[model samples]
Target: MNSSDGGTATPAASGAPRSGPRASYPAEQSAGSRRRWFVGLSVLVVVVGVALAWLGYTKFATPDVAGEATAYEILNPSTVSVQLTVTRKDPSEPAVCVVRGRSKDGDETGRREILIPGGTQTQIGMRTEVTTSKPPVIGEVFGCTMNVPPYLTQPAT
Candidate 1:
């Protein structure tokens, strides 16, 4: 029935389609809204990635002191001598290096810290011996750092 008769007309009787929603509210999302959401998420991810890269570079990329275990010798059953070559970016800054001994089964048997005194030379080679609880097959350099403990530093004269 038409509105003039004080009765509502069914959609089937009217020209409106019975299968889908009306044009006012669509069933699927609009293209513009979806594109905007995707662009916002992409920009957030790029910003987070750049922030992480900057943090990693500043913390680890360029260390003041770096060292390498050039050679090693199994001195005896419980001892391993390691030859370390250290390079200091600022030769005037003192640094400390940690060396370790590893067993055949890849277990860390022993560790020692050697001090690199500040000097005019940028590079220094030193040989140190590490005593191990178990027989060691090789010696390796763990890392070098400028954060030296109080005991490792010499007192002012």
Candidate 2:
């Protein structure tokens, strides 16, 4: 309402776009653009999902090298002797395995890496001692790989 005219002002008279419902929305996308955007996002999601699934499978699938802690003995207050069994898909490929000792509380107390030389046999057993920070009640085989560190490859001094 204008004080001079003393009457309600219509939107046309007020020189403004209509406010509230039935107003024209800005930046509206055509049907084609909306469909293209949807397809692009779907393809991106599928690609990412496939990549992630492949990564996870590679991690948990049967590995070329495997190690198991078959038995353990408490040799001393801070030492444990672990019997490790190593198996390789290709016995000709050398592998390295990591062993660990865990306390009764399930805390890792010690860790050691040992080398397994390539041989004709697919599986072999070895006993190694792990020095722990505290007494250990259990032993575990962390993992094994054919990628032997250079330090391990070096001959003893």
Candidate 3:
């Protein structure tokens, strides 16, 4: 085509060459792309959240069974004879049992290790004067696995 000034103005070809700014994709297409990206991000967040919750539940919800052993008074200090019992159930291999008693002021008055099988009950006997000004409180009575040989080996079968 020719302008009035006789300057040639080329017409855009059928496979048109763009003039000025190129046309943008339609609003619906851009919005759909954004929606898809958001949905993907949301799905990723949900998956990560569920995984973290499962981990937290497994880690924190389970109770610790390692420190379950306890001590009970077989005899008070007034008697000339005293007997104590320590029971361990389903203990790990090579377990060490420790029994500690504390005074009212939180002092370690006495401690002893009772010998017993891993999944059995053992009894310990002690005789001491009941001369403490304050009654004793059993502080800790628990068993833990130790990596040492038993002081008194069990008799051969």
Instruction: Give lDDT per model, in order.
Output: 0.89, 0.87, 0.47
Top TM-score: which candidate number? 1
Error of 3 at 67 (Å): 4.2
Backbone clash total for model 1 is: 0
Task: Give the lDDT of residue 19 in candidate 3.
Answer: 44
In candidate 2, how many clashes are counted? Answer: 0
Better of 2 and 3 by TM-score: 2
Error of 2 at 7 (Å): 22
lDDT value, candidate 3, whole model: 0.47
Q: Residue 26 of model 1: what lDDT?
A: 56
Tell me how many clashing residue pairs each candidate has.
0, 0, 0
| lDDT ranking, high to low | 1, 2, 3
What are the models' TM-scores?
A: 0.70, 0.65, 0.38
Q: Which model, 1 or 2, shows the larger TM-score?
A: 1
